[model samples]
Target: MKKPLMITSLALLAGTFLTSALPDRFIRDQFKKAEAQTELMLAQVAEATKTQPVGKPALVSPRTLTDAGELHMVPARDWTSGFFPGQLWYLYEFTGRKEWADLARQFTARLESEKMNAGTHDMGFKLYCSYGNGYRLTNDPAYKDILIQAARTLSKRYKPKAGIIRSWDHNTAKWLCPVIIDNMMNLELLFAATRFTGDSTFYKIAVSHAQTTLKNHFRPDNSSYHVVDYDTLTGRVIKKNTHQGFNDESAWSRGQAWGLYGYTLCYRETKNPQFLKQAEAIARFMLNHKNMPADLVPYYDYDAPGIPNETRDVSAASVMASALYELSTYVPKSNYRAKADAVMASLAKTYTSPVGQNRGFLLLHSTGAKTFERDVPLIYADYYYLEALLRARK
Candidate 1:
């Protein structure tokens, strides 16, 4: 009888611990709240479009990206243009509502021309976020063609000798060939293109880029710098710095998120052990950072001189939550799920909008760039916030 009572007590204590660590009810409710906020955004966009000319056959460039506390509209060709449609597609996925589906189709259709825009490395963000979801959910034949074309266009930017996709086309005084850590993300589209078309060209290019980035982008401590400049003529690394971070050596929060998310995702598609190990290292560095907040959200930059006084990046948190969810699946001994759940719960409870406000954005307190542009809502923040919720739901 005594032994049985002790076992029962231990079981009860374990249950309590897990309850404290996980917030299932809160995340479930957050999912519903996200769906509701998206519904309101649809109606608001419709009204805004009546005067804004974001009508039929127009690109997916409705108003988003907060500047001066107002969400400004970007051209459809803008790097961020895909997220608005991508959000609508996510809403449709969550609700199974025909209205959301109609809206998603309308917005996604406008970005078709991006398939041929060969100058930018962000074609993945613009195409995969919009058409990738469409292809995944609906199997729309047209989405397939668009994605393949976009992949081909993106491939044009790859510098074979440098073994990386040049991130920006406009020449800069800083470097001739700039390869950002963010460009690692675009490899997913190339992989997808290879799978869709049975063309080994896309697959080889992606693997090469990953290898080059893995060799050059990270530090001994595993925290990554934002940009690696290469000599285009000689394929040699010129400099490493954080263009968007506080300084060259300071670990930028979103840049770290991109490394974690990109490598985790790379491992998933390729099952490459190197990618897996790299993702885990980044995860450990981020989770074990002394300056990380109790809530698991981080300051805009880990080495920012302000420390606790610096603005917290909700965007980075959302990205981390979503990335950690996937990373948790790959490793056997990883405690990443607990941390992931806690971060999502924090975002849902503290950072999220209870007023259903912030121009229909979900999470707040996101810093765009540390150039005194602190505490602003961003379209990518909302997009990844919904994405993290969906991954958590599953």
Candidate 2:
């Protein structure tokens, strides 16, 4: 009787220790380590980009210096334009370098003139990352103006019939106004615009769009379809297609990441219970999948099932890492923070290449889509990876 009682007590104590005592200290230590790593990484990047030539202004601007002492520009027109200004924003924050500030301003001006338009569903990436960071770092009103104009243009894509923002406009079509998982990310601009302009209209529209997605796009288990079409006249889901995934019903890894992150952002902005719940569900579904690589990066789709030649997406890892960090802040008791921290450490240690100035790209294996020639080291991966690092810094 005594021995059995002692064993029961020990089991109870162990449960208490794990369920309460261990996690607080563990989270603190995890944050401390992540902060230290961010400091080192920032120092390394600053040293590398410090003496290198800015190089001639290419339509595709050169972003980083090579390992061989050569200046190599990351191409323009990629989703990474958002990140370049952001990197400069960090440089300004770290070193207080006026050059970084000036360069950021110059780039914002260039990108605003070139890319701001209605057809872009990526205003958050294109504007928030560049102009938003510009305003945050330097307090330039011009950046704010650029953002406002971009917001108005993006808001124009809102379809009253579908109550969702349309993502693409191909040459053959006239505002064929469809929604993709990727659009969740772009809606942040509207949400941010609402904050800036004191306009609830943008906020309302954004929420309606998100609710539409919640109702139509996500599966019973909270796994998401990549693309869902809507009938313009009747506002009904026309079809679900796997534009980037393996099949209509298949889970596209990055799409899942986007929904997880985007819904969380929406919840953060609105405190909407549904968005938060959806984020949690999607996060669980994404983390539980067997197809995810051990390092926490995922192949383009979970059901890329039999494609031995299927490629992994470092972008998915980066986006999910950012989402995990945000979700960690929002849902503290879920142990989601632990998972996020682990993913961050894995991304920093494993996927990061040591070849050129931290590889001039944070993530190595990203698949853009079949149409964009597939499985490339995408700029958006670099963007989100850096954004995650910055979030940890904050």
| Superposed model 2: Cα runs more than 4 Å off | 1-80, 114-116, 171-175, 307-309, 357-359, 370-375
lDDT of 2 by residue, 179-203 (tens): 8888898778788778888988888
Q: Against the true structure, what is each candidate's TM-score?
A: 0.91, 0.79
Candidate 1: give its CA RMSD in angstroms: 7.2
Model 1 per-residue lDDT tens digits across residues 1-394: 0001111211222123223444456555666777777766666666555554445444345444345444465666788889888988998898798988888898898888889998799988899999999899899998999999999999998888888888986658777888988887788899999999999899888888888999999999999989899876778999998988899999999999999999998898889999999999999999999998888889999999988899889889988988998898888467777678778766755676654566566667888678955776667888888888788677
lDDT of 1 at 32: 75
State the weakest 10-residue window (summed lDDT) of model 1.
1-10
Note each model's CA RMSD in angstroms. Answer: 7.2, 9.3
For each candidate in the order shown, give its overall lDDT on alpha carbons. Answer: 0.80, 0.68
Clashing pairs in 2: 62-73, 356-359
lDDT of 2 at 141: 76
